[model samples]
Target: MSIKKCRQEFEKIFKKYPDKTQALLPCLYVAQEKCGCLTEEIVSFLAQRLDLPKVEVYSVITFYSMFSFEKKGKFVIRICMSLPCYLRGSREILEAVVEEALCIKPNQSTEAKKFTIEPVSCLGLCDIAPAMMINKKIYGNLTPQKAREIIRRYKQEKDK
Candidate 1:
């Protein structure tokens, strides 16, 4: 979707709030979802639309981990590197499963731009340690093989 189109859709969301400042977070989410990431252009455009200072918009965007400031792949693979997942051998999974299978290390997107591997903090699934999330879906208690299978499925779906 074009930025103009996204801004048009945002107009409806913006209308819900009498105070445009109250619309900041939801407006940012809408922009991020539509534009794939929050670029400088998008941020500036949002500030103008919301009638807020650009610094205010940038500050909010920078504070949230869910909101990406840089371009990311369609599928972002976030492996939990918290204490529980670490104890469950998340390091091994990071190296063996993500790196070897996808040929992309943590914080790197695949050359084909299909996926990005990120090592994040706790994802609240400590009972099922060594958990990882692809987009919003969490897979836990993973073996290297299971991770490989998940990646394969996504790749196949993308291919199709």
Candidate 2:
């Protein structure tokens, strides 16, 4: 890992927040962008910079679904399972992802590492009930066929 770059990015984000605690999430994002996942080095760096305990850092990261400790596939597909989404046929949406789309189970990545499927409690897109997020983008009001096509298009995208 490039400590210099990491420190530069960390400090850049660190300066944006008056409350250092408010900076924790953005700092973690910078580290994750560089390393693909959080490392022990990142935890130590963040804790030292934020003047917080390592356990505190761990707790914060674990509580947020956006922060991943493990390196995910090229695309992370998060399906919503919240009540609003559930009422809107999210179960069918999940089945579409598993059966018609990637054919991979939740919390597992495809053999080719193209996608990792996850069942998230909520994406806070209640208005777009029955939504799924691929990486940072959201897709909503989906049918099985639409989900399959979406996955096919994503599969065709070259690694960035």
Candidate 3:
């Protein structure tokens, strides 16, 4: 669907809430789903639709790391860098994954336009240390080899 269609759907959802302020979260989510990141254009569009000031929308977007103002790759790879994951070799795994998959450092998007690698804090799955989240799916007990395999599968699916 186009971004315009997504915006219309978001406006419809915003109308359901008694207060436009309460619709902020869902609106942002819709924006992300539409554009892959919450761009300034989307924020302004949302502000106009909800009759809210641009500052309010911009503030929320800036405050939330989940909302990216810049473009991201088709696949977002979030590697857990918390204590548990680190102790379990998350660093090495992250390095290998970035080098092999994206050929870029963390917080960088690949030239292929297929993947983006980021070092995330805790994924809240310490029991399953060395975990990584692809898009939104969490994979635990990760190894460098396993990470590569998962990336391959994701690339194949994205290609289809």
Candidate 4:
């Protein structure tokens, strides 16, 4: 998407918020969706557009694990590493994904650029435990076999 288009989308979202600051998060989300990841150019554009300090925009990106400042694969697989997930065999699930599926460790993207495996602190699915997110979809109560199957489905999707 073009920068002009992004700005237009931001304007639409910005108009809905009573306070300009309240629109920051949603605007950033829209920017990320358009640009894939939050590049420096995108952050600078947002800072200028919102009349906020560039540092403030960068801070929000860094504070939220969901926001990526660097390039990520088409499918970013986020495995939960919080205590609840860990206690429920998330470690094994991670190993299965890394070893049997993508062949890339956490924080690494596959050579084909199809997937990026990341270990996040939480996915807010503690009740289910052992959860992971691929893009915006969450899968919980996972075992190693299920993780592999999910990875397989994504890989197939990439082929399509």
lDDT of each: 0.83, 0.83, 0.82, 0.87
Total colliding residue pairs, candidate 3: 0
Q: Backbone collision count in every prediction?
A: 0, 0, 0, 0
Task: Quote model 4's TM-score.
Answer: 0.92
RMSD of each: 2.4, 2.0, 2.5, 1.6
Residue pairs whose backbone atoms clash in candidate 2: none
lDDT of predicted model 1: 0.83
TM-score of model number 2:
0.90
| Per-residue lDDT of model 3, residues 1-160, tens digit only | 2367476768688778869888887888877867787766677777887889999998888776567876788888999998989999999889878888657888888776678888988988899989999888989988999998998898789779
How do the predictions measure up, each by TM-score?
0.82, 0.90, 0.82, 0.92
**Model 2 C-alpha lDDT per residue in residues 10-42, reported as the tens digit of each score:** 878878886888888989888777776788888
What tens digits encode model 1's per-residue C-alpha lDDT throughout 1-160? Answer: 3477477778888889879888889888887777777877777888898889999998898777667876788998888888999998898888865666788778888787789888889989999999999988989999877888888898888889
Superposed model 4: Cα runs more than 4 Å off: none
User: Which tens-of-lDDT digit does each residue in 128-155 have in candidate 4?
Assistant: 8899999989999999999999999988
RMSD of 4: 1.6
Record all residue pairs in model 4 with backbone atoms less than 3 Å apart, i.e. clashing: none
TM-score of 1: 0.82
For candidate 2, give the lDDT: 0.83
